[model samples]
Target: MSVPATPMERSVPRDARTSTARMLMICAWLSLAIVVVLSLSIGATGITLAALPDAIQHWLAGSDDDATAARHSLVLLEIRLPRTLLGLFVGAALAVAGAMMQGLFRNPLADPGLIGVSSGAALAAVATIALGNEFAAPWIGTFGPYALPISAFFGGVITTWMLVAVAGRHGQLMIGTLLLAGIAIGALAGAMSGLIAYVSDDRELRDLTLWTLGSLSGASWPKVIAVTPFAILIAFAIPRLIRGLNGFLLGEAEAFHLGINVEATKKFVVVTTAACVGAAVAVAGVIGFIGIVVPHFVRLIAGPDHRIVLPASALVGGTLMVFADILARMLVRPAELPIGIVMAAIGAPVFLHLVLKRGIGGVE
Candidate 1:
């Protein structure tokens, strides 16, 4: 390093990096488009691939006078559209949050829902459902349909704050202790949900169990509208923090030496992760492992840079969830399997293989 090359030359990696990034972007978009086509075409009613765009156009135009137009519009807008959008947003949010959690803890195995946030949200939702039963108590029965999600959001936020507080010391955070504390809190929340289920009447118990298992069956335009802001905000915010996250890979002291505001970055990650994952859990119940599995898969293909990994994860996660949702719908024909169960079933084998192949630290 006789001359210590110019800043631009040192900072930018030249054409190879640019070309690889462009190729990854192209592949991600192609994957997303394929997933969308599969989501629209594979349902029980069976809309043809050719007719799908026309159906979407007519629905958008609001000109549904003909029987075919009305049927197509009804299926596309009312059923498939909401479900597809929910899968997309929820997948993106969960994957982004998972990536942030892994970066924050410097651990490849870290996942958003591994913390208490999702479990806490689920427990709160179950409580709200149980309490809102008209037969249970007149005072609690006043809660409306929206109460459960609101309760879940609040539960997630509170639990996340508690985790942060417990894991922080003198402006420093301990990742190991944080993860352990999350496990402890998650166990407590799970037990509380079980107790609530045991005490509830039969109808409420059934509802509680269904909520715990998780489904995108409750997806609707209103739910999408409610979750969109948080999901989009976090999705956009995460990529901007990529440089900071990259610094974190060098450890806190080296990161700080590189001009990263380590504490602020950590806090931002924690809050953003909480907001995104909380919103997903609030709307989708306890869907799991997309965060853990999708980001790592993307990382394997895209490399360790958060710049590529985060966006790639978002696209792959959305595609995976949309396909999984399709499988959930068709798995039992008229009756639906829980999306959470489907994700866990797929994710577990993949996770085990990763552990065996790369150990807990993941691929370099």
Candidate 2:
């Protein structure tokens, strides 16, 4: 029989925890709505809140020959709208991936960037850009918009498989081993990327620079459409993983004893993470920190239950990127900073606080 619990061993009651978790979800969605409105309202063009209704209505009602409406439609529908949507999707994807990784590894620092997924995706994308015009011209011409994303997805999946092989030992995953191997892989990938960047012509060089650093300036209907399926699938998939992830926090053996298929869950997580991160990297280059930081922030407010952390992470992550994109636009006037830089700037403080509060020896 299980031993009797002391006061410290007692946990929050189920109904109470569920009540609070529901409230957290409500708040997260509400905040995301506010951020979206703010993102729409603030942009380079003279579009204001008042103009938004007519601008959207005009687009929905069919094209207007009026120059003013045309300009508003161009700015809102073509540019800001897609950019905001991309941020939302990419941010939500990275955050969900990070949360799952953290829960699987049982560590806060198990980031996509640190685990070789992002770097591998980046390397493949850079290689695609480097070779697209010269070697893969036929594929590029045939695939047109999808060639790079396809390559990135395969690269991310392969890298995740390799990482798991390297990091798994004695039928267990070691956080430290994964960290060390990830660093080595990331270094090699970075070096390869740099070498490719060195031999490129001006336009190729420009593509390399933008993609390597990361940005949402390339957001368009095509890019947005490319990422939608991954984001939606991940969103749809999160509900299924909650029970396994929650059990994981108690320990894997306990999870298995509770009737969980531990091996299947691990494989599912790795595969889903690869798909999510791969799609985000393909479209947005490589915005980092969101994956590592947003889930922790959600945990701070909503508690560490994966049921709460996963969905809350999605909403909070979407809200964060939407506002970050807004700040990126307004920070340097007409010239915008890379969204990656913006994420790092915001995530640094949050990460520092988590480290300090949790301490190196006390990250559970």
Q: Where is model 1 more than 4 Å wrong at Cα?
A: 1-21, 49-65, 134-143, 170-172, 358-364
lDDT of candidate 2 over 20-92, digit per residue (tens): 8898889889989998888877887758666767777778877777668767877888887888899899889
**Root-mean-square deviation (CA) per prediction:** 3.2, 3.8
Over 4 Å off, model 2: 1-20, 164-183, 357-364
Write down the lDDT of every candidate, Cα atoms only.
Answer: 0.82, 0.83
